[model samples]
Target: LRADIYPTLESPSATDWADRMALPVASIMWTPVASVTPDTDIRRVAQVLLDTRLPGLPVVDDNGLLTGFVSRTDILRAVANDPPLDVWG
Candidate 1:
């Protein structure tokens, strides 16, 4: 039978430990960047959003500077049926 123990298993190698320690911390922002032009229609914008599979698209001017963001929630909210679901922290 299996037992519930506070500490278990063999010790990890120093190399393995060091590799884990060398990794970046969780505080880093890890989202992919997506951009779109100002004149692009919502239909085309929707396609880009789907192709990229990202939550938000960064709206940009002709010069490729960030102007605004169009998120998944924004797209979902556009339809009259239902609101997007809440995700808990």
Candidate 2:
């Protein structure tokens, strides 16, 4: 999760803050970013999300177009509504 989501104190101290403000955002963002294509396998995409610990992944097309996005919550909701799998010994 992004650190910005947390609430800050009204009079927060900056003594503990790092000197990272001068760095460009691109330098701090994750590299070789993971993404899913329109035709990407659902199972593979889910696994990637689980492995990367990212809330969601950008959905791109073969032409490198940003079509949409998918998130862990979306997958969980889908699985919750789908029929359960049957198993037998």
Candidate 3:
């Protein structure tokens, strides 16, 4: 299960630990299915993250296969570099 859903499992609504362990992973997973291409500009990636309220997104290739994952930290690092990546650059 995703860490994002951890709090929900601790709430009163959730069953006890033993019962939760028996449940399926699919029920609590955060599967936004959002992704970006390797060459997609940083601006677009930031926009998608904001729209989905997700911490990160999967990076896919032209064949629709997972290549890597991009998180908000990655974007921040890019912008904070000595020569920050510009929207046009």
Candidate 4:
């Protein structure tokens, strides 16, 4: 599978991430704590991505710190197997 194969994405701000927590998104977001973990295995992350029915996950570390972000693309890019970058600009 391609890394960057997200179905729908809406660019929003940091506050928006929280504002839309209960609101429905076009795609599922990784559970804040469960999805974000430093030691979290990418494969497991991918599984979470698949399981949660989301295109990607918000990367967080232990203690609920937002570290980085991860999508299928991020993982695939790590392995140099990413899908084509979306050109929305």
- Model 1 CA deviation exceeding 4 Å by range: 1-33, 81-89
**lDDT digits (tens) for residues 1-89 of candidate 3:** 23464565445344666575687989866566888999999999999989988888899999989999999999899877847666675
**lDDT per residue (tens digit) for residues 1-89 in model 2:** 32532235344345423444456778667777788998888788889998987889999988778899999987877676675534451
Query: For model 2, which pairs clash?
Result: none
Top-scoring candidate (lDDT): 3
Every candidate's lDDT:
0.66, 0.73, 0.81, 0.65
| Candidate 1 lDDT tens digits, 1-89 | 01111124256567755765576855333445567777878777788878966667889998878889887777777643344455552
Give the lowest summed-lDDT range of ten residues in model 3.
Answer: 1-10
**Per-residue lDDT for 37 in model 3?**
99
lDDT of 4 by residue, 20-88 (tens): 565664455333344657788778988887887666776766666778778877877865544455657
Question: Candidate 3 — which residues are off by over 4 angstroms?
Answer: 1-18, 30-32, 82-89
TM-score to native of every candidate shown = 0.50, 0.67, 0.69, 0.48
In model 3, what are the clashing residue pairs, if there are any? Answer: none
The residue-level lDDT of candidate 2 at 67 comes to 95
Pairs that collide, model 4? 3-73, 36-60
Enumerate clash totals for all models, in the order shown. 0, 0, 0, 2
Looking at model 1, residue 52 earns an lDDT score of 67
- What TM-score does candidate 3 get on C-alpha atoms? 0.69
Lowest summed lDDT over 10 consecutive residues: which window, candidate 4?
A: 1-10
